[model samples]
Target: MIVNLSKVISELESGSRPKGGVKDGVGSIASLGAEHLESNGGFNFKKVKYVPDEFFRSQSKGIIRSNDILIVKDGATTAKVSFVDDNFPFKEASINEHLFRIKVNTELAIPKFVFWYLFSNYGKDQVLSDFRGATVGGISRAFVDKTQIPLYSLNEQKRMVKLLDRADAFRQKRKQAIDLLDEYLKSVFLEMFGNISFNPHGFNIGKIADLVSEVKYGTSAPAIEKGKYPYLRMNNITYSGEMDISNLKYIDLAEKDEGKYLAREGDLLFNRTNSKELVGKTAVYNFTIPMAIAGYLIRVRTNEKALPEYISGYLNSLHGKQTLMAMCKSIIGMANINAKELQSIKILMPPVNLQEEYSKKIKKVHNLKQKMLNQSEELDNQFQALMQKLFS
Candidate 1:
């Protein structure tokens, strides 16, 4: 049966149970300073404060406790929510003006169950829809407290919590498996191609321009109606050089234009523009799609002399990133390393046979990545189903 949060608050206050403050506790998110808290994925505590005191001078920063629900109320991250773990560092840490910390008397509503409710489609819609702002959006405390919450008996709450706990466990294991895959790849690369500084016999260090044909960016395509032309952006590149297709968009390109932007099999895609840390990230375009790269990406194709896989593995390596960073020149808060700059960068040359051997190992790792990714997707689907069952 459907339930209203306001009614629950009222009922709790009338008899054996009593509800706390209902008034919105925070102000516009613009008030918070750059300092903020960080949440650890697999840790004893859920939140760690990075926000400074200067940021909270005027706002009535709300307290967070174990099982307290935290909803991000502003900016692009709106509606993102986290539950305060029992071991969270700050039981009384004041949430910044941009976040709303919510709690109900434990007698009336189980906090974890409430967390599951807020995590569901109904909860997400309520939180995100409450956001009000033109440029940088925000959600009000009043909106959160008044948002309806489903009520279940204490026993039912316990059951749902147990189910969710198990589901989350599976999710974390899959994530760890992905992380292990990355670590294994790095180990493989190091074993095959010794660290740049370490040359047992003798090694050749040369400028990168000597190894490859050219580095070039894809031309911009005018936005197209939803269709099949695969359009990829820099954000799609993962740390392990995999493409995330969840938010993948397509551009309708004329046949003539297709040749210019379409990504070829084995073509290496590098992020040419983004925040300092994000720029220089790369992924190999493994899928054979009539795809066009976005303006922010650069495609590096090799000549007969240099193998594409050789450069791809090198670029994804630590040494490749350091070289790219050295060539980066910042402009107006954004850093860019042009094709010329990238080409001029230096790398240690491994023999063609050795390069091909490393490439085979990398391909094996990529295959493992695809398998783990498929498993992750399956776990995600199961979790989503559980969420719907717990809420509905």
Candidate 2:
């Protein structure tokens, strides 16, 4: 189980190698430098940004080439590493000085296997452990060359890659399904609610504040690990409106705080603070949890007349989203939506029955969405497991 990576493969030791880091500019590799690097890409560069030499001197920039395995040196994204495939635009790429590219001996070690190891949890931990800095962390080149990595035979690596490829394919399909469902829901909403300009016969324009009973902000309670109560931070919710329980945090709260923050079934959680694209994102709880909402979110409880499904769908609609965006005030780093602003936004009023009808359509769409997302998650898990089996 304990394998010495150096013994099994050759190490592309760093020193006198080109060094570079992320920059806020775009240019070609030859003109930029011998080293080419990208800050973030999905293992391919259908769209990617290149680092500028002005930020890093010509001598300090690290050398990169096609088929190189990039290692993010520092930052919260340290664990993310990708192999430079043929599709990359640059003949050579440079990395953020915080990142280092691993040029593995292809004959001794499989590039895909090396990429998988760098992406694994264990590898992430290893990279984090080597990080040296106070405010901004960074991994040194010497650290990477000395770090141990496992190696597998070419045939075994190929087999593992095949399995992983299949899993990735499945994940892609799931993502497509989710996207399709989203489009379907949008079409259904327009069909039922009409364009924002008008509504179905007899429907009237309604102020959102009047329709909802109470709009309250979440708690700013102290958080603790493994506490009695869970802390639902805004990050716990995804842009796609799914609950990510894996990274859940907890807090210890007294009875008063518990009563205030405890999320019950039918409650709607809205992300009030985030990027402009995600500021107005919303999710409804169809489940129960003893948790306190963080300051970054708001909890809205609808009156008996208003339905959770109807509100959730409406909030996700184009008109609703536009209204929320209009209310948003953006600061340097984040955009914020307040309760007052949210309430003042306008929504079209349909009859209670019509609202219920829209709710049912959303439910059906949500079912298909959930299935697709579950499949995507399953595929992602399987791919991760395959990486471990192949490299470790």
Candidate 3:
């Protein structure tokens, strides 16, 4: 048998309206945002924002409870979903206007089972069909209530939930393992170079311009949906200087533009303009495929004095991060450090041979890291495939 969405569940709620704005400050209640929802099964509390305590106290509803389902009701991330696990500790938290807090009727259906179903293609297709917004898409409670869902007996739902939970746990384990390897790389760096922040070993400090041969900004070329060269943007690089090509965009850069804008191996890409917290995030381009950097990124080609690998590692280190943050200048709302300013930043330059040796060691560790990352990606892909199959 099948039922409409509202028929199968208990509650549908949009969270507290912001009194003034959602800006962070000392607040009585912790508030949830769309950012807190993970593509995976958990919340990243570090990303959780806040709501005024008085506002939360006045609300008759919208208080988040454990076991309630959550969805991003508006914005480009519309249709994303999560189920509040019993293990979730924060019971006082409420959602922002951009989310819908759902409480499934537990007696009729398992919330966990329904949560996974929403992430499936069937659920997404329904959501896409009901999408209502001109600028940023949003879903109304009325739209969600009208959609139909497949029904299963309680025992079957429990069984399916168990299987999916196991798969999810396995995928999470793989991710955690990769994170450990990344930490190990940082540990090794500190052991060899001893935190570049204070130059604990008393190495000679040199200007960034003295170590790098050339520094250039990427083109402002307009990008098409599909193109020849992969376009590297700020979001493609992680804070730790690793390249995440998952959401890479492409551009049809002209032939003449390629020679100027195309980035090669060993090039360090710096995020020159972004939120202050994300400003100066760096990534080393190691992919052999031809790729072009976007206008917001500055490409730094290191010379013999500073090995590309060593400098990338150094710049992403804690000391490097502190130094970069200090050098940042806010323009409009975006944080930026121009090429000339970037070139003037101080760096601890070890002997060329020593830096090269450290680079070799870093390469070996990265080789291991890539292997684990590959496995993690494969596991996620397989699990995703299974999820699609169940609701195909």
Candidate 4:
């Protein structure tokens, strides 16, 4: 049977916060906003905010409980959902204005099952189909009143949830393994060179301009879906100093512009403009193929004095991020660090040979990580196929 979400859901409403907004460490009560909801159907409290105990006591709605479904109701992350599991860190929590807390009738459906269903492509499509507003996209209560879900017996739902959970666990493990590899690299960097900010190794300090042969911005040409060469944008550079070419665009450049815009292997790409937190993401281009970079990115070619890998590692370090964050000029919500400013940032001048050794080790780790990523992708495909089979 097919049933509307409104039929099985007992509570489907959003919450609000006080006039001045939530404060950190103000109380034990967690006030979760859309940022706390992860795209992978989980919660992240790394930057969680808190509301006062007295304010929480006064609220009759938005109190979070285990098995409740929370959805981002507006903004860029609208329609994103997360399940509040039994192990949720906070004993008392509530949603903010930008989130909707949903409670399903346990007599008719399992909350986990419904969460899984909504997390699937089938459910996301239905929810996004009703998305409204141009500047700030959002979905209305009508989505819950009209969207239909496949109704299964409680026992059947339990069985499906168990299977999905097992498959998801494998995916999560793969992701964790990848994250561990990154952490291991960070540890190795610290062990070899020490913290760049503190300069514990007492290496000579110099500006990035001294170590780089060239520093130039990318082209301003618009990119299309199909063009002569792959186009790299700010989003292509991961915060961890890795390239994510999964979603790429293409651009055709004139012969004159190719020499200026095309990135060579070993070049360091820096995202010069983005939100303050992500304004300086740097990655070393390891691809052999020709690719054009967008205007928001700056390309840096290292001289014999420095290695691209070493520079990339330094820029991705905690201290490097802090430096960029401090130097960047914020206009509205976006921050920018021009090529001149980036080239002027001071860096520790480690010996070239030591950087080479670090580069070699990083390469070995990257190769291993690539294989694991391939496996993870295959597992994701399998999980999605299963979701389609079961939910569709």
Cα miss at 245, model 3 (Å)?
2.9
Tens digits of per-residue lDDT, candidate 3, 209-274, equal 988998989989877898999999999999777889999888988787787899998898889999
lDDT of 2 by residue, 174-291 (tens): 7767788877887787787775566655467776676787777888876887888778888887765656666878887788767677777778888999988679888876666566
Give the CA lDDT, 0 to 100, for residue 261 in model 1: 78
- Estimate the TM-score for candidate 2: 0.74
RMSD of each: 7.1, 5.5, 2.2, 2.2
- What is the per-residue lDDT of model 4 for residues 49-110, given as tens digits with 9 covering 90 to 100? 88888999999999999899999888998888999988898888899999999999999999
Ordering by lDDT: 4, 3, 2, 1
lDDT of 1 at 185: 77
Candidate with better TM-score, 2 vs 4:
4
| Candidate with the greatest lDDT versus the true structure | 4
In model 2, which runs have C-alpha deviations exceeding 4 angstroms? 1-66, 86-98, 105-110, 121-129, 132-138, 151-160, 197-203, 226-228, 252-259, 318-323, 365-381
Alpha-carbon TM-score of each model against the true structure: 0.81, 0.74, 0.92, 0.92
Preferred candidate (lDDT higher): 3 or 4: 4
TM-score top scorer: 4
